[model samples]
Target: MTTAPAGPDPTMQAIGQAIAEGRAGDTTSARQKLLSLWSVIGATGDPLHRCSLAHWLADLYDDPAQALAWDVRALDAADAVTDQRVQEHHAGLHIAGFYPSLHLNLADNYRRLGSFEAATEHINAARTHAPSLPQDSYGDLLRGAIQEVAEAIALRDRSRRASAPGSTA
Candidate 1:
């Protein structure tokens, strides 16, 4: 196998800069820089940096599919490098998904792909990973979301059943 180049990765730094700039004009450059960083970080001898870069790359990508793929990679990298902080944060983030979080992202992806079953599965997965399950407003909100997904799946199933031949109403 061909050996990867050894050095400090300027590409990741460039990606961080471009991302911070937040100019629509810099999106293309930012994406390219992030991709390049992802390629070299694996060989650069730092799993934390690799996981951080992967997380940033996933956040930088606007497309849901692309984001999902990158986030999955970030999670893998975090696990590979044994980032306990990332692991703990990941568990919380998946549940407290109030904003730009992974749980919402994965749920939206499954929804877009028309996999309500998978969407519900992810919602439950998020709940399981939740750091706290206290009976508070936040917990209620989480429960509501899970219930909504469940109801939606039930509705979808009922509709499908109705459309089947000789189905009783």
Candidate 2:
């Protein structure tokens, strides 16, 4: 007999799914649902709840500047989740596990707003944290994402330099 892998809190799972739905193009409904969940989770909720809600909520905004604000909140919430509390809320979760993705999102948001320096800073942080992730598919995916973002940043830099005055292709 096969056992299903344990998941996060039911509320968190639902919120995550709603965020995925938003990512998959149901922004209007997903935003409403996420806002509702955020209300239930509250500001002083469990650290895990706050982290998950804020992380997912970051993506709901059309404006990268607004999204970056939510990303900062998510990172703060993740940092607030101590090891003891992590074990209590979800055995598999660790603050280290959240860093790469959080940094990646921050990098993307910064890049979107044309803040290349800040974006590169977060990308470097993400790369530093990448190896600490579990040696699993998700970890691999995050690493891939980090590489992709790095390449994109490099390409953007090249393009910018190429277009600068007195610059040769």
Candidate 3:
């Protein structure tokens, strides 16, 4: 099978830059940049770009509702992402590897919103997809997060975890 050119994607670089801006505490400009990119990318644009952008965009907001909207967009775009598309980014990457994090984020948002049932559903989904993760620190992190969110779901904890992905605490 022929491999795609190994050049970095400019769109992804832009998204990464925006994410860095947010992490650097310039969330407003980061959000603006991501939204502007979203406007250009549109809903039907590159699923990988949409998924990555929406996933990071969700982190820019502290509000569960707002974050939930972006998380949902990320999940939807993830569904459209093909394994080939993911492999194009990196040879070892797979679309299935994206689900655990995507679902975990959704579960966390739903839990914070006090939607216990929905949170439970997504946490379960995350668990089911956990096996797709590589046996590395990243995989361990997601597995640990899955357990943490599942515990919170069972406890009916509506409060945000200090360790939650988007938490500044």
Q: Which candidate wins on TM-score?
A: 3
Span of ten consecutive residues with least summed lDDT in model 1:
160-169
Candidate 2 per-residue lDDT, tens place, 37-122, comes to 87887877877778877888777776778778878989988888886666655665667878999998888777767788888999
- In model 1, pairs of residues that clash are none
Superposition TM-score, candidate 3 onto the true structure:
0.93
Q: What is the TM-score (0 to 1) of candidate 2?
A: 0.78
Q: Mind giving the per-residue lDDT tens digits that candidate 1 earns over 76-131?
A: 55455543433343332321233223353355446545677776666566556444
RMSD of each: 12.4, 7.5, 2.8
Cα lDDT of model 3 by residue, 31-150, tens digit: 999999999999999999999999999988889999999999999999999988888776768899999999999999999999999999999999999999989889999999999999
lDDT on C-alpha atoms for all candidate structures? 0.50, 0.75, 0.90
Error of 3 at 59 (Å): 1.1
Clashes of 1: 0
Q: Could you tell me how far off, in angstroms, the CA of residue 111 lies in candidate 3 after the best superposition? A: 0.6
* Predicted structure 1: lDDT: 0.50
**Candidate 1 Cα outliers beyond 4 Å, as residue runs:** 1-15, 23-25, 43-45, 83-100, 132-169
